[model samples]
Target: MANASNLVIFDIAANNITGPVPNNFGSLRNLKWLNLGFNPLGVNQQPNDLGFINSLVNCTSLCYLNINGNGLTGDLPSSIVNLSITMTELHMYGNHIYGKIPSEIVKLVNMTVLELAYNFLTGSIPDSIGELPNLGKLDLGSNNISGAIPTSISNITQLVALNLESNMLQGSIPTGLLNISTLEVLSLGDNNLGGVITEEIVGNSSQCVFLYLNQNFFSGPLPSNIGRLKHLVQLNVSNNKLTGDIPATLGDCVMLEELYMQGNLFEGEIPLSLKSLKSLALLDLSNNNVSGSIPGFIKGFHLIKFLNLSHNTLEGEVPKDGLFSNMSAFSVLGNSLLCGGIQALDLPRCQVKISRNKRKTFSLRIILLLVLLPLGSLFVCLAFIFYQYRKSKKMNGSVAVLHDQQFPRLSYQDLLLATNEFSPGNLIGEGKYGSVYKGLLESPTRTVAVKVLNVEVRGASKSFLAECETLRNIRHRNLIKIMTACSSTDFKGNDFKALVFEFLINGSLDNWLHPGPYQENERNLTLLQRLDISIDIAMGVDYLHHHSHTSIIHCVIKPSNILLDEEFVARVSDIGLARFSFFNTSNINQAQSSSTGVRGTVGYVPPGNF
Candidate 1:
């Protein structure tokens, strides 16, 4: 006698079963949902008995089958897709399943979430994987997969995350990866992929939050569209062959931190545009061809602790402040141009000495004849000296009026006593500018950053002048407010200069944006706060470019520069160092404002007693 159709729920998942999926599964023709995941169903179970799943070919009513997270082995059943068409979600992670992902699975057009991470799956990613138009997330990380990521993936407009990390994948990234304005998290790191970085980068993305392409063979120039990733946070493209100079356009990522561009061949000067990343921390440009001096233009970013610019061609004296003093480990070795630091392989002291013979070869006869012949010259010289003195007095008077209208006058000792001799005890944190010390005034403790210009550098004199001129008159709520300048006699009655700024209570946005070895609760930022902070920074930037009496660009826009107050409001730190620093500048409001304060160059404070 024939038996009647059997009815079963068929919903036992993660039950730790140690056998192949039973062929008897088809017996439950009425089964709608089946989950056989988290089981030891591999070679340790039934050897090569996955064929049993073929028996379920007749289970036309099955809508959800989650046999994921198992140790399933051997080739997948060819009829897997034929057995289910209504599947909306398929999670097949943490398995040892070999052979190619069945092209048949692409027939599940209704599938929205497909997760196959942490598997031994091989074969090129099927272009058909993009058949699911509603697919929101497609995670294919941690596999032995090979071949180029198909361009067909861009057809899925809803694709949010595309992770292909930890594979033997090669070939240039598909050009379509760049055009998706909605693409958020993109990770193609740790692969054998080669070619230029900008070969396929879509430069005008509005929502790319995190980008990781480390450990590849990418070369050539990075795209200038880098400025368009306004919402970008974590950018890692280390261990590549990228050459040419770093684009100052990178200053556009207002919320970025955790920048890793080490082990490349990037040359040219460090772009002064980086001074705008007021929220940056953990910067690493080690092992590159970056040349010239690391100026104090970056002194505005005040909370960096891990900076590594070693192994590059960077020259001049390393500033003993900020990431320099705090993260001595930040500077490694290999640069032939760098000099004078407490770190390993101390930097060279660059001083030019004239030959003693050249100095002693003066002619006495020429001097005597000149003294007799220059009596007429002496009368003219005296007249000129009087005129020069009068001119000096007039210029001083003009400078005094300019100073009153803009820059505040503070003594060099004011900064010294405020920073406790810039001691480690009073140190609060380091910034892109220099060492930031928590200064205690008479009664109320006022926190401020002291930008000690690295005077010993080869061309640092230009940078000192540049900074003083650039920041003397700039003022904004979101920008770090420079209170005054301090220049006075040193121990030997020489001179030193320092810029004073308001001390931030919370260190940097990096701590809250990406907390390390700590709970989410340790960070006090809320979703509203993050959004508000983002808005505040954007508004501040908008003001600099459009609303200011004189437009300025904050070239660096990483997370370290976004400072949060006790009230959780964000203020953009570091104002205008790029224009006066490396000549790197972007955007303008077309507004023509007068230069009210001193010129940007005359503020240079010589490093030593010249």
Candidate 2:
């Protein structure tokens, strides 16, 4: 093979070939194209496995070389700078190549396409990378590259696609990078990039078709002139610190197929102007401050596939057409005010409004009698109830207790210290009843999730008592383990109550399923993993329903209540709404009656419960 000096093209891609690449490629002096892609050419992990590239320098006519997906390791050699000056394309992505990209690579002035993505290469990207005048496509994504993206990249006049996503790049996006007239694909997601995206950045990228800016620290409103990108297809700015209302002008991007703006501080109603996005397939605006009614126009989005608007303050009747009719394709959870969706959503029925003119008017004397009679009776009943409550309080004292004697007790001060005085930074989640914080205990030397009940909220105290009673005796591998309970008064003498549970390292299943900004890149669950989680959840629910000493019903079972350990094992949590059922026939009917009324989260309630 070393004597084949006249070989102009050598192609051996996707053959699953193994072993080290031959180092005699220099013998093909006239070689113009070389492809050994998708082959296990260097699986032996030998040192200097890429020394073969040095021999390719002798092939003066080499114009293209592809060695991608070869499992090749070792530092990318600096000798690559000596490659033929005529080289136009170099592909070495999907390998184990490490070390810095040589700054001398600028010497390959004729290079047009440089694909070195999906490698272990670290260090800052070379600024001189912009000097490749003919370079049209530059992909350096999914690496450990750090430092700011070079503004010099804006000098590539003919640049087409620039992907720097899933790296550690910091600093704001260079304005010039968005100004390129010929640039189409601009992806810089999952980085440490910050700063407000200015109008000039969005306005200048008229030719851009794909724009990914998710999972960053970028703040401020999306530029209103973003509509200038008429050709934009997919726009993702999710999981950033961006605020302000989503721009109505965004509707002008009629070609948009996917729009993801979840996990931001975006507010206001879904824009009516968005009716123009007839091409939209996936739309996620969950975990934002967006409010107002779920628009009926969304039902007109016939091409929509997935729609998520959970955890927002949205209200009113949820439309039940098109995407909404498909329970698996859309989610409207956490918006407690939403109602009247498909039966599977189990939302409250929309109330019928009656016109004022249709009602009969009551006489003034009857109105006063009706109001004053109730007021007099309420005052008398309250006085009698207050006397009895005071008598009962005097007899029992103010001390709260868990019926079980096995669990240890914690004080308000102990919990306050463990959670750093309930610092906002330690807060991990919030619910209608309370806020959950991650805390570290000193005596036991363990981490725990501290759920502090907000006594001010109606039913909060009841929920706390219910949780303590439910978790006291129930023991299952798939059930969250309770560490202790706090039923003491704060320094202010106000009643304070909290429950401490063993912390799960991986957080809740909700994050794994519909990940927020920080969890976006790291919380991908595989199909097999999902199946395992489903089984774990089923076993937990089965134990609660049939296997426990007294059959218990976990009235509220949702993703946020399901915790995951480091090994991805699922644990059912938040049993505050649980109900116990005794085996006796008489008690069984009583248990069924006690479970009536609004028992669980609106969206997660079983259809029969409605």
By TM-score, the best candidate is: 2
Candidate 1 Cα misplacement greater than 4 A, ranges: 1-45, 49-69, 297-305, 327-329, 343-610
lDDT of 2 by residue, 449-552 (tens): 99998989887777776676677778998999988777778998897888889999999988888877765376689875896688689879877876676687
Q: What C-alpha RMSD separates each model from the true structure? A: 17.3, 23.5
Lowest lDDT block of 10, candidate 2 = 589-598
lDDT of 1 by residue, 453-534 (tens): 5445443334444445556555667766776655455677654656677667776787787877844457767675777687
Q: State TM-scores per candidate.
A: 0.56, 0.59
Query: Cα miss at 152, model 1 (Å)?
Result: 1.3
Off by over 4 Å in 2: 358-610
For candidate 2, the per-residue lDDT at 275 reads 83
The lDDT leader among the candidates is: 2
